[model samples]
Target: MKTGGVLLQQKTKKNINITIRNLTISDITHQYCNWLNDKETNKYLESRFTEWNMQSLLDYYHQKNKSELMLAIIEDDTGTHVGNVKVSAIDKNHHRAEIGIIIGDKNLWGKGIATTAIGIVAEYCFDVLDIHKLTAGAYAENLASINAFISNGFIVEGQRKEHVLTPSGWSDVVLLGKIKSQE
Candidate 1:
């Protein structure tokens, strides 16, 4: 049972298409990294991950090793990869893992792109994987992410001061968690 649990935690072959696909080498060569490296995108996570080069993105993808899968977010109707999401650090034993998402289509901001994607992915994480909980953190400055997480039923677990560093300096981080109800 333990070994089975470990295997389940590492499973990553499932590629869910629909506003999200596993990135390809072309994405980096064509400047998909630019979208990811933008400050607006980084506002919630790394302050300057723009350091990642094309080869680095490629190598990182190759090195991911089934521990997690990173998917490219694309519009279902247009097939344009506008964002990305990752369901990683899967712990079948603890039945929890972190969830991260981003919608880079600046024009689509505040239009519910994120809200819908959250529902899609959360359903997969909780319903399909039977994972008991999902967790996420957003920089205190990123109200959009905070609202989306809250709207999706993620409970505010806590806050950490100076948890994120930006070019301007340190910022707070809001921790959130969603545990599946036994009901």
Candidate 2:
């Protein structure tokens, strides 16, 4: 089902069209639920480790916590629900937050949509939310994810050795950070 959610913000490019918007109740579709369960699509995601139920998602949505901002990532031309970008784990005292993205549409992989999504969300985190810094982490093997953040002005800050277990073996976590410019 189409979210028909209000367009809170956007960032566009020739190969990528990102509509940053709030998620709606209608977004709880079978397609949305399936993405979380798709092993291949979620291989690099932390969510892949847990199971998601529709009712549980709905409950979480209704809880109305203000610590995070979750935005829907919609493909412009096809109006497909490709994924979501979120700025969560906010620390107001530190003026920082963490960001994450999940591009559920495997067909759109290798495209620049993920990078554009990060740019849009990071802009919001810095400009609108007044966050001084934004941080994210990716598995050592997830080059695409690392590139996306790097292209959006993030830099590798540190690495956590043997952070997560993968099929091959344990992998390090590449920590990334981007600070808002004083100017």
Candidate 3:
């Protein structure tokens, strides 16, 4: 599904306006690649395990775009490509999908951009894609990520203790889920 135009918009708690659109290959820039390579930016992300470059990022975008709904989060006032939100692992038979997000711009962290982006993508998954359930997982220590999902109505479904190995030590994986209301 190509979401080229403005899919949704929301003013973050910081009053920063943002919108999301499908992430095209053209959106994969050197700066975008750098985000994946940044230590702080990818700390909780599996991408931190890999050294990313332009070609690698482009290949990833091409691969994911084939099966997932990848979107770019844009800062409206500046029109900056600040981040990405992805709806992946779509199980059509079960009407469920996994949602993942990364606010690449460190400057925008804690600005409610992630929360607003998750809310927009969750709505698209339920209303546009006809998905009944949306799920996400975050590193136990990543409170910002967990809170972002929670702010969008995702509930804590379960936790897998010491599920992932981090630089510091093993960390739990917090699983969260949200089911569409039966209106």
Candidate 4:
């Protein structure tokens, strides 16, 4: 496909009426699934899920136990879905959570959209959500994601060897973390 899923989820100040709100229903279901399942895109992601289609998406949206949270990322000027940011396991008591970003739109890659999106979400995590610790695991082979996370105040915790696999083989996973205390 033409990465229509990415385009579908993008929500920025320029698109839609809710300028400051995150991408909601427009994203949760179909947006990332298409790119995430693609062989090329899956190369960088740690996990690849198989159970997805239009019907599966609809089913997933109705579930009450979903702990994961996602937000669509759009370019400031063009209003395009270059990627997305996510967080999960939001423990209000612990004020900790796992966070992630996925920039499958090659055309916008390396242009700082990922950085901007991450920065905004991290602010939301610490400032709005009052989360103390925000963390993520990246495929070690994906240096771009590592740099993006690290440059955004996230520090490397360690590397886990051969912890994940793509269609081809196993790859190491790197753990990164940041705390509101550090900021």
Top candidate when judged by lDDT against the true structure: 3
Q: Compare candidates 2 and 4 on TM-score and give the better one.
A: 2
Ordered by TM-score, highest first, the candidates read: 3, 2, 1, 4
**TM-scores for every predicted model:** 0.82, 0.88, 0.96, 0.77
The list of candidate 1 runs beyond 4 A from truth reads 1-18, 21-29
lDDT of 4 by residue, 107-160 (tens): 656666565566667777776677888988888888888887887899999999
Error of 4 at 98 (Å): 0.8
Model 1: per-residue Cα lDDT over 35-151, one tens digit each: 567777766666256566677767766775357756666665565777767777789789887888877778767776666666667766776677789998888888898888888
- lDDT per residue for candidate 2 within 1-183, as digits (tens), equals 112233644544555666778867777677877888888877778767768779866776566334467678888777777888877878878988899888888888887888888987787677777889999999998999999999999999999999999867899999999999888
Q: Which pairs clash inside model 3?
A: none
Better candidate by lDDT, 1 or 2:
2
lDDT of 1: 0.69
Q: What would you estimate as the lDDT of candidate 2? A: 0.80
User: TM-score of model 2 relative to the true fold?
Assistant: 0.88
Q: Superpose all Cα atoms of candidate 3 onto the true structure and report the RMSD in Å to 1 decimal.
A: 1.5
Clashing pairs in 1: 19-73, 19-74, 20-72, 21-72
The global C-alpha lDDT for each of the candidates, from Candidate 1 onward, is 0.69, 0.80, 0.90, 0.66
Candidate 3 ranges with C-alpha deviation above 4 Å: 1-6
lDDT of 3 by residue, 94-143 (tens): 99999999999999898899998898889888888889999999999999
Error of 4 at 114 (Å): 1.1
TM-score of 1: 0.82
Ordered by lDDT, highest first, the candidates read: 3, 2, 1, 4
